[model samples]
Target: MIITVAHQKGGTGKSTIATNLAVELKTSLLDLDKQHSSIIFNYKRAHAGLEPLDCYSIAESQCRFDGQRPVPEAKLDEFLDLFKGDPKTDLVIDVGGFDSPLNRKALFFGDYLLTPCAPSGTEIYGLQMFEEILQEAEDIAGIHLLTHVLINNADKRSQKRIAEMQAYVKGKPEHFELCQSVIGQRISFKTAYETGQSVVELHEGARTAKLARAYLHSADEMTALCAEIRHALGKGV
Candidate 1:
């Protein structure tokens, strides 16, 4: 199963979602993002003596863009095939923030395409633009696709804002599906990643009482999200 975390807009916590989800699922990750965030995270994990994730990277130079947009490269199929060809392997891909031939191809090849959006006006606009791009990809591929929208970094105190965002996503049932699991804005997410460990792992070794409590909360949320994702994929709840 090829699960891709992608968004054409930046700062939507794409890498955060990808790294945490990959760790929780214990799956191989393909870092197509230009920043190579997942590759760096794996490096930290390896040095920290944690079981390093199986990670790979493809340089942006590999994709040739025509004018401003990327032109399809035949080698892309060969590259993606390395990850998607195996039916039994679960591959998690983190794509960059841009509309390009490479990203569009990833969307077409993905078994489940997930887009993380923060609860804000700007992110909503970006999501709308991504919807257009997804539509274009569908037109080219001759098949319809739905991008699961996960609300990330949600403020726990602002229930109204989260509700409004959910309604907006629910209004477009055909194009997007609102993920049942929501990831909140928590400090543990940042602190845990700095150590190259997921919240699930961090809670086990938390140094202080407050740290342990915070990590435990984040871990529970992450675990629930992973379970929801697995259930959606028909693996189990």
Candidate 2:
């Protein structure tokens, strides 16, 4: 399956969600973001003496936006074709936060599209604009599209705001649906990303008792999030 994580606005924790999901689910990662965030994370993982993930970087000099399709349609098709109907493997794609040919193409091709949105004014408004982008992609692909919206990086302050987000998402049920799993804001997420580790793995390497407890909580949250996503995809319970 081609699981794409995309949004039109940046800093919604896309890389965090993508890398952790790929690691936790044991899937390959395809980084289409111009910043090459996942690629760098994998590099750090390798240097840290951990088993490196099957992450591919298709950005920077290797990618060009001059054409209608970035990296060629056949090239992407060949890669996606390998994963289609293959229950054993999944390709998690992290696309950049912008309206471009590459992002639109990913939307069109993804078997399951995910958009991570933080519960904030800007992000909520941005989702409205992104809905327009999704429509445009569907127009090109000649099919209706729906994306799973994940409320990521949430905290106590945002907990009350989830109802607002839910109402908006429910109002547009045909466009997107909110995931039942909500990922909270935690320091472990940042520290693990910097060191190229998933929260699930980071908890094992914690140094202090307090830190260990925090990391363990983060790991539990991540596990729940991954479980919910997998269940949605009918992978497993």
Give lDDT per model, in order: 0.82, 0.81
lDDT of 2 by residue, 1-237 (tens): 878899989888898999998899999888888777887788788888888888765434364321112334447767777776577879888988777886787787777889998787787899999999888887878888899998888884765687787777778887898888778888889899889899999998888888889798789888998898788778886
Minimum summed lDDT over a 10-residue window in model 2 is located at 64-73
Instruction: Give stretches of model 1 more than 4 Å off.
Output: 59-75, 82-87
Candidate 1 matches the true fold with a TM-score of: 0.90
Q: Which residue runs of candidate 2 sit more than 4 Å off their true CA positions?
A: 63-74
Clashes of 1: 0
**RMSD list, candidates in order:** 4.8, 3.9
Write candidate 1's Cα lDDT for 149-183 as tens digits: 99999997988888888888999887899998889
